[model samples]
Every structure is written in structure tokens, then in C-alpha cells.
Target: MKKLVLQFIYGVVVKAFLRIIVGVKFDNGKFLLNEKQFIIIANHNSHLDTMTIMASLPRQLIHKVRPVAAADHFGKTKFKEKLSNYFVNTLLIQRKRDKENPANDPIHKMVDALDKGFSLILFPEGTRGEPEVQQPLKPGVALVLLQRPEVKYVPAYMKGMGKAMPKEDSLIVPFNCQLVYGTPQIISHADVTPILEKMQHDFNALQEKLR
Candidate 1:
């Protein structure tokens, strides 16, 4: 029943809003259909970033793809938590660590999701910064990759999402947005530094290509 609702939301509602209302154009979208579990990392700009990525995916995979979101923001209130969980099917993690409970870390939660065979949509920037500006990615993504060495990583860059729905605004404007997917690659490195560097490089290349 939950899967049916998610399919309806992503396949019909979100798809229509992104494709018709917002005019989203997807490049290399075929990569999103890969059968293997992987992580799709992208720049964070607006709330629409998650919805846009979700809508771009194939309807059958809606239940298999989970977006990693901040617990404080998306799961702060009971109503918001239910909406994000039941509607979006998000995997909410704490952005701030609890000093007493080491097990409550975000990286552990993310890796657990991957182990469960769900492809993740991650915003490495942690939070949405200024509109249209790329911020330095947090090392949490690199940490996750370190644990799941075999999982493929796909780079994605989104444009015009900020203008369509800026970080400060709740009302979405009808503007054309673009989402570009880069080739998926497995970064084999003993250290997180090299993994993070390669991830940033891939994201930069995708952003340049989008322009």
C-alpha cells in the first residue's frame, strides 16, 4: 500500500509538476535506471532538488530509491516527519551528532540504508546554501563510500532550481530547471581524502558540462 502511494506521487503528481509545470530537462537520465544499488550525489540548492530527482526516476524504482535528508529540518516536527517518511519515503539522519550515542551518527544510518539494497539520493553539501552557488561538500558522503567500497557513485548537477524555489522561499516559481547525470564510477581509495577529491572533481565536470 505504501509503495502504491509512492508510485502514484512520483509517477503522476511529482512528474507532472516537474515536467509540465516547472519544465525540468534531464540529461543522461538513462543512467538512473541502473539495476544495481548506488548513490546519486548532487548539489543542494532548494527543496525541489529532492523532488526533481525523485520524479526523474522510473516509477517502478520509486520504492527502491530513498532520499537522505536532515532529521532536524525534514523531521523536526511530527507532521513534517510523517510527511517526509510516508510521502517522500526519506531516510532522515541527524546533521548534528549526539555526543553520548556514537551509534546515532549519520554515516552509520546512511550505510545501513545502502546495505538494505536501496539506492540513495544524497546532497553532499549538507544544507542548501545561497541560490545557484555551489558550496563545499561535507565529508559524510566520503565516509559512507569508505564503508561501502563496492557501491557505485553517480554524480549529478542541477541548474535553475534555486531560482525556481530558492532556499528562503516556500512558493515555487514556474521556471525551467535542468538535471544532468554523470557516468557512475566506483572510487577505490584507502583514504577518504582522495575519494572526496574525486567526488568533487566529478561534480565540477558535470556542472561545467551543464553550462
Candidate 2:
């Protein structure tokens, strides 16, 4: 209840600042569903990728979406800290040379959320990418699916964002950008790799089409 009010207020502020300053735009947004706990996955291409995804979601569902971000990136800055806590609901995961198994830690919080039928937004690429090309996907999302096949899998592709607002650059490019949310899919344990692979291909194809 308290979270809902904060989401409403923060949603307006976040959306306003983004649309006005970053010039972000959302497209094909009706496909996002509010039913099941979702394992929303997408390609990683730009720094604004996180904000773009959040901005594209429906206001009511916005409070439920949490982005699994690299601890090394979003955790480094004071400004990003607040944004992550508020907007991203940032689940900081270790993406490093010698990382510990997340399953042994507070990751139960993620499992618990799914248990409670909460939705989440995450990147399969793990981190940012090279230019317009998406970064290679990690097996983490699928592993999450294997643990909870009951979860819905949504494939979203954000185009023009890499150019609209890039990493290490404060200047925003005033181009009409968009986010494409495809139909949600379920990844059963049987032959799951192909589904994830195809989804990655489909996501990249959609981004290219949007571009």
C-alpha cells in the first residue's frame, strides 16, 4: 500500500525527467501483462537501458519490476544508489572474476518474491555492450526459469537508446526512441536452451527492426 503511493509519485517524476530531458519514448507497450510473476529479460546495449525499460512499463505494474544490475556499476554512485533503490529496486549481483554463488545468500529474497507472485525485470546480457550490437547473454535468466518455470518470460527490446543516451556521456541525443515488448513466453525445463536462444535472436531482430 505504501509502496503503491510512492510508485505513483516517483513514476511521474521519473517519467517526466526522462521524457523531457532524455527524450525517451515508448512503443508497443500494451503487451505487458500484470498477471503472473514475470522473469522479464532483455538485451543489454546502453546505460539508459534500465530507465528505458522502467519508463515503458504500465504505472500499476511499475512497483513490481526490479532490475538485476551489476553491483560494480549501479552500486558505485550516490545518485545511482537512490535511483536504484527507488526505480530499479536494484538487485545487485556480483559479476566478477571470483564471484560467490548468489543462491547461498540473500538471493532467497528473489525466490521469495517469485513465490509471492511478484514480477521482475532483468538483463540476460549481464552488463552493457559494444555499440549497437547486444552483449552476449548469460545463463542466469534461464537458470532462474529452471527454478521457477511457472514464471512468465517477457522479451523486450529497446531501440535507439544506445544512441539516445550512452554511457560516459551526459549529452542526450534527441531521437525518438522506443521499447518493444513481445508476447510473454514460458520456459519449461524440457529443452529450455533453444527457447532462450531463439528469444535472444528474436529480441535482437526486433531491436534491429526498430532501428
| Predicted structure with the largest TM-score when compared to the true one | 1
- Superposed Cα deviation of residue 177, candidate 1 (Å): 0.9
- Model 2 misses residue 90 by how many Å? 1.4
Write the residue-wise lDDT of candidate 1 on 1-211 in tens digits: 9999999998789988888888888664555676487899999999999998888888878889899998888899999999999999999999875547657888888888998889899998889978768888788888888888898888888999999998899988888789988888888787878888888999889889877
Steric collisions counted per model: 0, 0
Candidates' RMSD to native:
1.6, 3.2
lDDT of 2 by residue, 1-211 (tens): 6467546654677667667876776664546654556877877767777777776777767777777777666778788777677655776656643326545333454565677656777787776676467776776677667777778788888766767767667677776666777777777445658766877777877777776
Question: What's the lDDT for residue 19 in model 1?
Answer: 80
Candidate achieving the largest lDDT: 1
**lDDT (CA) per prediction:** 0.86, 0.69
Candidate 1 weakest lDDT stretch, 10 residues: 26-35
TM-score of 2: 0.81
Candidate 1 ranges with C-alpha deviation above 4 Å: 98-103
Clashes of 1: 0
lDDT of 1 at 129: 79
TM-score of each: 0.94, 0.81
